[model samples]
Target: MRLSTRYLVPLIALFACSSPTTSTPAINSSAGPAGTSVSSPSSLPELAADPREPFLAKAVASLLSEDHLLQRKIDDQVSREAFPKYLEQLDGGKLFLLKEHVAALEADIDHLDDQIEAGDLVLARRGAALLAKRREVVAKVVADVLSKPFDFTKAETLETDAEKRTYAATEDELRDRWRAVLKLQVLERVEQLEELSDALAKKKPTDEDAPARPPEEIPPTFEGKEAKARKELAVRFETRFTRWKDMEPLEPAEMFLNAVASVYDPHTQYLAPAEKENFDIQISGTLEGIGAALGEEDHFIVVRELIPGGASWQQGKLEAGDLILAVAQQGEQPVDITDMPIDKVVKLIRGPKDTTVTLTVKKPDGRVETISIKRDVIKIEASYARGAVLNLGKGHEPMGYIYLPGFYGDTRGASKAPERNATDDVRKLLEVFQKRKLNGVIIDLRGNGGGLLGHARDITGLFIETGPVVQAHAADKKVEVLEDTDPGVAYNGQVVVMVDRFSASASEILAGALQDYQRAIIVGTGPTHGKGTVQALVDLDKLRANPQAASAADSLGVLKLTIQQYFRVDGESTQWRGVVPDVVLPDPASYVDSGERSLFHSIPWSSIAPQPYKVSKHSWTAAQLAEASKKRIDSQPVFKKVEAFSKALKARRDDTVVDLKRDDWVAERKRNKAELDTLDPKLSETKPRVEVTPLEESAAEKTAPKTAGDKNVKKRIDKWREELGRDPWVEESLLVLEDMKKLK
Candidate 1:
């Protein structure tokens, strides 16, 4: 989450000049003619009164309108914008209400700010109610549609991009949309089944040199496959409905709260209790859970990804893309969750810090296994900085590489030195590098989302002797310049900082400061994730508390507010436009919709007067180096193919509509796969499917014989080491370091 706030009068003038903000709420005339069958904005039904809302309203109104560090006011213009934002938040897919329903409520659009001000949620409640109604109707309509096999030969298309779509005119039309969606799903699945059947029939090649038969299924006769797909899809829909039914009552309120929160800035949020705890866990870099981010896929709960230091990540047995079959507690029968909702499955998986849960998993290669995993409090090892000494050439040139996954601080508190922070770890690694007499060093910040700002300052201080690291301007026109107080340079060697599009917030801060100071050759993708704003989390309980007694609404969540905007020493604000690297690398994800600019209502970029700073070192002539690197890449066929693949992927991403015709749909799928295959083979090599190390297996701490947890940890280390070997990003960074060494 990245953000910012107001400050100097010039900043005020900048915002004011952009658009003339309305003082009073104004109704948008574009809603419709006044005499149309649709009623006026004021006619929307009133929300039922709740006792807690008054207190909640008082807090929200005060925060967004006045108390926010930005002091941003929710005037008529902002409110009108909220109407569409809130609608999109609820139904961006255009899956629920009809245009008539939207028109019926158009009268409410202009009046949303008033309700937000008055602590009323009539419009929000209406949207929620309509979604609920639609969900129920969709379940039934989908069931009815799936009762018969889909006509794959039918010439038709369905708009996949919901943003470009209009609401259906009636419930029947909505059901038709649902029917088409189910048909597409069924068709997609039958194709999968066809491929699976063909692969099953083919015998494995005995010769090691011979390649396996291509998975291209002989044209499916469509025989009984469509019926089987429909049946399977019907079961999946049943699970979806069950999952929808399990929706918590507070979810709508939470969504409404977020809708209001985003209006202030994207980073500012009202963290519910569970959300707050999760936030704390991320900050502390420890938690008690499976440590895997799970998602519902094809009616089965699947492991979408794993946290580096999380339990699931430690257990190398549970791989990403593996479908979770069932979950069982200790000494209990495994409950088959073929059609079970994900939340319920998660609840079963997460438990007391020291317990056991068995997960039945189906791997991508069709292997099935019941893996018992001990639920230990997982410390996110990946979140911390790890070091590797790379030998550049056969001449045995050694270079130190430290990968900071996030700007994690010593949450355990600094007793002697700084605790388990990225700064302290980097300092240790740099010390080791000095001992080894390395040629150059690479500080890889790729995919690092960022954490503590203080850590970033201290980390930057480790490189530069002393100077201003970052400058923050609050809404009250107060400028607080954060400087590197430590007058010590740990690493004076030639340096290269590696970053990517995902390097944001604190990551951007450190990279920006280094680039400005000319202390390091910033290498990798251009413009890191732009998030140069500061958020201060305030507990609602503390705000509402009296000196002696607290309010009963302490159960209400904490509010993260955008307090200030940060600027680089060079005065550039990394808000919409993040820090550009000295040497821009060819990134596969460059074409993807990413960074702060992609966010709705992100603050505009600005500049303050640049702070006075000195450059300690300058080895590489950046322009010449960048030009040389660009030529090296542009001339290569592999890089050229990658660029083409990226363009094609982005084009497919932009093309929202998908053909419903089975032949067309299948053909489109094949075309994409073929195109992807034609590109560099390494493009398909996503992440290393790795195993455990021997060190993790030597678990002397546990008295019991080889437990699943111990074995899992060992397997994970093997994968981690293997990943380090195959990582092309790391390879590129080393090459950049070599380039830096040659520069004079």
Candidate 2:
């Protein structure tokens, strides 16, 4: 469960100069126009309200009713369903609000539909007020609990899973709950400090100049470590509370509207202005910003990774794991962002090209420095398709390996011809593979969350000699079979497509089509992410009744409306049940309950009439390969350990009640770490089974650097090749390809 404010943002000005009109049909509502008068609930507490929210809500409701895949009405039933969803977005962990507060909110649950229909945000306003009150109370409770030392010897347990617990019956119960939660936080921090201390103590000096750590430098006592943890946790909570208090009314309103949208399906959503812009950047694989991927950790905006050849990477000052403390324009005072929302922080940092933005960041080692970076157009090279050549040491042929992070396309460019896209990139790689005459190819789609549907179709065509790729079933009961009419295959070699639970949407389309046509063997831990539904970005600005009120409508945001459900060429819909792979691998991800099936209000699986298609001549029987793979897996020590690790993970996930006692917690952490170590041995410790190398042309490009950006590009490619060489999955794919060669 994610908070509503998480989606609210003005991240970048990349596409701010242009507002591309969506193809989604505009909705005309009978509920008057923008700024129409609606009766407000006098009983509800007064809170700042955005004038554009009512119009946005009205437009969203109209669009969903008219164009949603399910064509479900926004009635009393939807209202009842939305109420709990709204609550979940507000207080997902069941931490802030008490049982009495939930009971009070539930009073207007049945009439929520009426409120939305009337363009009145009575429920959202009331809920926001209640949440604000609870947040202040919770903050105080957290501070009070962390002030005193906890009894580490007491054999107490804490129910960590939010779903398994209910709202606290009373304020006293809530206080006790916070006590346990804070103790767990402090205990985990203490364990981390102890581990660091131990690692430092055991370190060996490499040279005479290398200074050894003094005995006095290490914190010897557990009590001191506990005190440090508590102090840090107090600051973390203080920052969190400050951020929550600063949240705008639009954020809650967006959450409330999304609850209404989600009643139809999980994919159907309302994208706030900033969120829509972010979505565009993701699909296009480009952004004009600082070029650093930021993530919120303990309410602090931390730089996760720097895009190669990006502004931040070129600056050479910002590093991954650096916590941004403040933002300042050129010659401006630094604005403190201690607990600011990540989106808001991004808004301050992202600007026009050649603009200088100063960021005050705290390094991992606690060094604080202010660095200025000139914002530029950042092309996310990692998001595009890239390939490498893989070989098994002796008496084995080299196979082509391509990893596509997403089915990306330049959406911001003219529709007639995009500057760069996934299909073109993959096609170029295939051409190189064809030139080399590689016996087989492995397309790794693991952890790919999908992108453009058209790109998925085009890429699938690159592998096969043209066929029906997927079927789209619309709200009007129309079945449209999307086919790849292209006449020739790019590289018709023995193909192996790797997937995991995270591979979804466009990823599912390609994998499922290849599997259905018998063009490739799908190998994964389990079924792919079953997000079969298609969503269209409906610009709410275009749905306004009065076109002259352009200024008012511009800020209305966008609705990501679910319009259709896609199915495999074999007629089976990858909705609740995703595409199951031919070969199952022992992976910890398989044990986790996730994907479309785990999502609330997810559409049920359905099938249509199978499309006409011819099976590939190069097809190998999956059963035979499965049998061979199973035999190898059963004998392999690594796979055996993987199986044990998966089971242990499943057991841990099932049992959320954890021991809060410091000693017990430490023991459990050690056991978990030991399991992880066995599953993921150090890269240096493990011998590489498969050797990965760049293609001849790619190697030449790496040596001939025309600019500093080219050097960074080479570094990225080299890093990719090294990581691929160490991958167990890639090794397995190599062996599988070898088996295919023999079978052929």
Candidate 3:
């Protein structure tokens, strides 16, 4: 798996002010026992070593000190902050060592800023040596614990949130902690095996008149299944332990530097050379794989987001929060991926197009299922600004729909012939609707995470006459106003913008501008994701001439820095508090804490004088639309079921501790599955099993030689059309459009 760089995504307008600005305190204490453990600095992680250590250090210092838009000062306060952050970066769980080890490392906490300023990392290196030693101690403990298994009924609990707990006070306490951890793992797998055994005992729904019979090769007893599960779980943990033993200095150095960058913003991060290349592949968006975004949480690779036109979404089997347990090729033995990093999981899932990959995943409800997906070129079809007609019955008015997954454009390409972009694609769709005499249009930007700023402005221009859409400002007070200069409004009879908490950056920009002018009725789950900042990728290799440094075994990586802030035309910066919609809908994401406010060191939200823009042709108060939608939701059965599921999902998310008791745990999962089943009926209707032909294209237009990619895209179009009738959110948005139509 290739490592990817983290970018600061400000989702809220947060102001940071704390920790006193001061010089380092005078200390008479010399190097402590922590520093003495490593006689020489050569013993540090191998990858952490850089022949141009001084040069790299100075280069980073110069950027943070002078070039960064934030221009954060690295004083004694910053040193104090970096101390604990770097410690967490090394060992957040406190599983490796006792309290004394942490105390020893704390002795040099006051000098980290000074060390960085001086272009020396001796203090960081000393801390790294202690961490390496602690890891070795724990590795041996894990090996011994996994050698044998027992005591499933020990009635012990393991606190999974390591950051919230204190360090082990003694070696005995640390060993006990490790034991509890292993017990929990064994209990989880035992529960899974029990479920599997029960599943095997039943006849599949498709088995026509077949008798309920277990497979001849498999074990039927509970104890036998438990033994198999335990052995495999232990082996997986052992493999992870081996990887820990292979850690190098480079890993620690990267972690430490990334921690420093995080102090400014969680998004600002250091990327290794290999990781930088991976980042480029990700930006390209055309990858041969199952089409899913993988992220690590609590050391488990979880499904983050399914690419709209990818195999995962098309399969409609996997969901966000599903824990990927193992990966297998066509006929190979399944390889457990528990505790493996996300990059490795990606490499395992990706393969040549048309190849088959099977993923064993544990659902959020604790139900384990194996998803078999054929790998293909996963492209962002929704990101292409696609159009479809939402059916509203035989006699009802035809409502047009467009799902803009992102404000995408050829930012890196020369805007040459056949330049495909979000704005252009959308304009073409609007023109198509104009010819169709559509009653209304719904622009869906539910999961749009934003893209090019230029496209956002042009997209917004398509709705309104001439007006300012967004404003960009630098720290030096340089301000630029981006506006829609054209007065030609495209198909402005009625407009509705569909958005969600995932809509961010340029998505927020376009949504905010249209809502401000009352040009469109905004209908969504809630406020947009408050990511109102811009990032510019800066290459460390290009920062200076001949930056030939002995930086580990790879070339220097790139830095994605937050360089500018974006504000809506209404004078409000969409930094922290994103754009609020006219008609709000119930969403599971709203139950969770998110947006810019959830982040640390986020830029504060402020307001400037509002820019002048033409009033919307259709004048209607939001209360009218929201009130109409509310009335509709009060009696909506699908919405009622959706609300119940949202409550259940929230409860499950907040309560991280799983019931260790097998019977109770299985019962709990059953209840969750029962609750999910009610929504499944509606969900399955939208995401059908079979492929669908587009309703808009002419017979001749639809006859193009369809590739696998084309079919994948058609699924998205078909599913959206299906959802136009089943999805309460879309139904409600269509209702909102009707209310706007009446008011106008």
Candidate 4:
């Protein structure tokens, strides 16, 4: 829980955005009342007709702002060393309030923009002041977040009016108790700077070689040396803050509105008009670009996957694993877009059809090259599919593995019954597993970015007999329990749920429920994503159409706000802590930064009422799980090799930059490869040729399954089977399940 200045700060930078280009408007109005008091939606700015897109856009923009971006960068530099304590002081309730404020502000901006576009300057200025007021609120909250110290005594948080009063009182008490913690951090840093100066001031060589005192034990002196050291430390903070201030300025209303929406949940956000339109276009499969999905990877703009028929893929020069280093339009110089936000990069990359864009790509092998491609529509078929299975190693021990990448179904078509959704797909997989008499089932929820909430609950029901799956807390502090109501327990024998850093939101809920019930063994990287919050899609357009503020763009318009927080049965928060695994595994993803700690304005870990149920003790306790993992780590050569590889990578991460000397870089890489080859020779082999066995019908049970054709249902099923068969994580999960069996 101790914060480290050196290792913690840079990682957070990955999530924070640069500063704004324009000056934020100052608030002349008196500040809103500080204590817990909910403002009526009618009293806020108008929401747009389709607000989710705008909210998402604006949220992304705000997250990329200078203050947030710098903080995240610093966090990453420290590799989560300081995060626990850093998150402790955050106000969960205030977080919701802030997000609501942001959403309202975004609505105002959206309205003013609409008015301006329609030649209404009078309305635009009115929107302008609301923007100013919103900024003031945001600035204060940001300051508060940085200044506050965490209180461990506030165990249960308020989600209702009475609870808020109690919660506020508890926080006040804890805040007073822990105020010294913040002061101590500053005192400690200053002490370190002073000690270093003292060492320098000593003239004797032997004295210089003397052991330095730990940061805390050094006494504060009144000498000029102490004064100089303090001044130097101040310079450091100034430099860090200046780096934050250099980024782009968000339009006044945008920052205020998005910050408000974020308080509800990390995912709920305000979108600028441009960002909203682009996201819609992307969802409709109409984006013109290289045809790849992108997201923040540490501080880099990484390509998540490629559309098979997209311009980038068709050219075949670019692969799914390549990282985009820079992007340049036809007439502009190539901009070094490394560490830039995904949406901004997307904006730069996307354009009209046939427009040429040049990209600098970096391969996993460290080879760098440039490619020029024309923009075009690309279908993203690989992101989601059906028929994934769990393999019990090479023997096909009949453990079903299903990968639900996202809860996806085209809800657009009128005749499309939503019943044929992710849950349905899973039910079919279960049926197949049951018929095959599978020994157990492994659900690979790893890398699922989340989608429909209903699908997630239904999916949990497939494994658990029945129970309350998750509890959601809204603005009024009312708790709504989402239950797993399905009576059918399909292939419930020996379930193992595999999750990693990217398994989030709905995925976290499902994993948490299964773990809470001991219905499944949760195994994977250290923790699942800590996104235990919900979002309400507010329509800013609708708000603007109201007569009360018809001309007040600032008052009547924008935001998709987050209005709730969620809790697990144990009353432990998943906001920043995430769900810890029963058995931990090594993953390449651990080498890169991801998850809640990597995001800006993420809600701090807090808890609510526990579900009226108890977790069944795991067949093996935490100690036993750890011992078994140790045995496996020592016995399995592959595991050891991966660990060693990680250590070497971490050493590299310790370096700030790399030399581009071709021969030297090549030699170093060669040496590293040789070392890796010795550890796990299989890693050097070509990508494994994954041959999926076609669904077999025993000659004894010759029943032909019904097929729905032209809909591509059968084809989709086959493709899913192929993907599941090839999944390495699924294979790894089966290994862990076998380990669990032995330990039991």
**Which candidate ranks first by lDDT, i.e. highest?**
2
- Model 3 residue runs over 4 Å out of place are 1-49, 198-218, 285-287, 296-298, 321-323, 338-341, 362-369, 379-383, 411-419, 547-554, 671-682, 685-695, 698-716
Off by over 4 Å in 2: 1-50, 195-225, 273-340, 345-383, 410-418, 548-554, 678-684, 698-707
**C-alpha lDDT (0 to 100) for residue 438 of candidate 1:** 78
| Candidate No. with top TM-score | 3
Root-mean-square deviation of Cα positions for candidate 3 versus the true structure, in angstroms: 7.4
Of the pair 1 and 4, which is ahead by lDDT? Answer: 1
Give candidate 4's whole-model lDDT: 0.52
Task: Write candidate 1's Cα lDDT for 1-744 as tens digits.
Answer: 122222111221111111111121112233233212334545433333344455665576677776565677777777677677777766677776678668766666677667767777667655555555556667778889889767778999998667788888777778788888778767765665676565546646453212222334333567577886677667766776666654433344556667777777777776553344434433443334777766554357776556676766655578666789777787564566764645467678889875778887865433355666767655545455766766534653667777787877655434655345677778877877777687788898887878889989999999988899999997776778889988987887878899888788999999999989988878876788898887666555444535125332234555677778999998889888988888887777655666888887787899889899997666577887787777777775656666776776667677768889978987887787777677643733654321212222111112123434454444455566676665655556666677778885
- Per-residue CA lDDT of model 2 for 135-229, tens digit only, reads 77788889989988899999999997787889888788888998998898688667656665766566655532122334454467988888877
Worst 10 residues of 3 by lDDT: 11-20
Each model's number of backbone clashes?
6, 0, 19, 79
* lDDT score of residue 23 within candidate 2: 22
Provide the lDDT at 709 for model 4.
28
In model 1, the runs with Cα more than 4 Å from the true position are: 1-47, 198-225, 235-252, 272-290, 293-306, 309-379, 413-419, 545-554, 683-728
TM-scores of the models, in the given order?
0.78, 0.79, 0.86, 0.56
TM-score computed on alpha carbons, candidate 1: 0.78
Q: In angstroms, give how far residue 35 of model 4 lies from its true place.
A: 44
Better by lDDT, candidate 3 or 1: 3
**lDDT of the structure predicted as candidate 1:** 0.67
